[model samples]
Target: MTKLRLRQLVIAAPGPEVADDLRKVFQLGKPFHDKAVAEFGLKNSVFSIGDQFIEVVWPVKDDAPLHRFLERNGGAGGYMVIFETDDIDAARTRLDGAGIRRVWNIDLDDIAASHIHPADVGAAIISIDETRPWGSWRWGGPKWKDEAVEGELSGAILESPDPNGLASRWAAALGIPATTHPDVTRIALDDDQTLIFQKGEKTMLEGFCVSLQSAMKALERADDLGLKSQGDTVWVGGVRFVLNND
Candidate 1:
């Protein structure tokens, strides 16, 4: 069987303060600063949420891709969807057969990573990362295996003018089939993760959902931090977070 799970979600913010906002709102612990991103003229903080991660990147230079993304979104928004796949060889064949362009890719002894061109996918940059020894993620950094986090990343919501069309495009790129209904189109992934494409003015990775153990406390923290909170939703980094309380 094909083994792939949503491992990380990346967001691009206009400024670094958005990182602080996320940390406070989600009650997240210290983040791992990935020095590798400096090559792209960006700074990032990767926060561990259980086995998953939420990363925020802000552009340090005007020529960065995150800078252009921020300019288009008018602020902070979802940047990429990263997946952990046990079978990279299979994925490579399928993506190549589908004619998807990979903007960046790396093959290492410990991990294999590829960044699919956003224009080919329509929602966000798709990254398929394969780790060597099963669940050990090279990107999470050392000493993070002992860290326990209360929240779990559940899914992401992609806004598109044509939900079914975007879903089909995503399904094609992921080498899966899209299931469409009257309301939204869904692309199911492993670990009960899903990509939900919904009707909107344009195509973009709009927001994501997080399943939190201390759900109420998270919302309260969001309010106390002076971030906008409404019902079961909170606004951070100009993106909506639909809270799923455990």
Candidate 2:
């Protein structure tokens, strides 16, 4: 069975200003482009963070799927991680056989994409997009144009009620080897990316707090610009970070 690789990370926010917050606090550069996926009533910006992207999606319509997500998950956090696959249909077939349901399907001329909800996957939602488009297409809108630069994703920090169980499931689903750490389980991907799942006492979907390489520098810069720190965690503009205890 072909495995799905992590592609993009999603950050859900209540408004467009969150983009600015992410840029200033994380020194994340500029917005890549805007995607107006009409089918989903989604108008969003894609920001480049090395080879991966941080997608900020805001609902164009009150009835859009994003609106419902915000209502359920509350403000900002990692919403999903897209995966790359050679054949989406075949992947979908495999997921369906395992009783997973597709949440959305995006058709872009010759390419197609789909997402599996996190509730079914046991962690973050995963999307599958074809690689052919990356060879030709530019992401995002003109107003906030930027390009992806190469860098290691480092790893993902996820909190779940059953981290070991989730790690086992992902090991089978992603066809990767998983190792048990003192507090979290780590799954290393083919592209030098890692996924870490930490067991939390709660099942509710709380927002994630990312830690970048220059986080301390970013925090210092943010402080000079009037950003406040909550203990060691900083709240700059609107971008927030919490130290990963695990």
Candidate 3:
């Protein structure tokens, strides 16, 4: 197959305070570590969510990428989604052949990672990373085994201004067939991962939910931490979201 599975979803916030709030609500244990990035001189906090991660990058200065994103989106929503591919080079070759350009590449010996800009993907920036048995060097955080959650990520629902068009493009790019239901359009990939693109009147990041197995249980756990729950979804610190009921 020319496609890799959706492995992780990333959310970028304006500052570490928002990130820390999310961590507390999601009960995402302590951050893996504090690190500095050369590009924006921003400090980044990485957290684990299954085999995926939730990375919060804060700018050290006024004119950083995180600042730009905050100015554009006004707050947090869905930032990025990462995929795991067995052959990074081959995937890059295919995307290039299709006239896609990579935004950047991370070379850390153990893992090679690259991102295609959001404009290319019709929405969020998509990152592709390949790793050996140990893992990717560019990704340093708590291991998946350490996280209390279980089961592979089922999928993420995205609210889009142009849901139909975006859904079609994603179906082709990710090699997943698109299926439409009464309320939403879905693209199903392997490993039980899916992307649901829903049409929204506004471009706000609200009104979407993540599907997991134990919705009620997860909601209770989140509530114990002063989080709020509605139906099967838990809203943590007004940012992080956890859903056990599909």
TM-score, one value per model: 0.96, 0.76, 0.81
* Tens-digit lDDT track of model 2 for 8-127: 666777777766766776667667545556566776667665556667766677788777667765565566776676677777676677777788777776557777777776646777
Would you list the C-alpha lDDT of every candidate in the order shown? 0.86, 0.62, 0.64
Superposed model 1: Cα runs more than 4 Å off: none
Task: Give the distance in Å from residue 82's predicted Cα in candidate 3 to where it truly belongs.
Answer: 0.9
Tens-place lDDT per residue, model 1, 31-54, is 888888988999988888888999
- Superior by TM-score: candidate 1 or candidate 2: 1
By TM-score, the best candidate is 1
| Superposition error at 163 for model 2 (Å) | 1.4
RMSD of each: 1.2, 4.3, 3.3
Best to worst by lDDT, what's the order? 1, 3, 2
Model 3, 1-246: lDDT tens digits are 644666666666666776666566555655664454647667777766556566666668776776766677766556677777777888677678777778888766677788886676665777778876434434645354565344345666666787777787666555456898888888876677777788876433342245545556667776776666776566642344646553
For model 3 the local lDDT of residue 134 reads 33
Off by over 4 Å in 3: 34-38, 134-138, 142-152, 202-228, 236-242
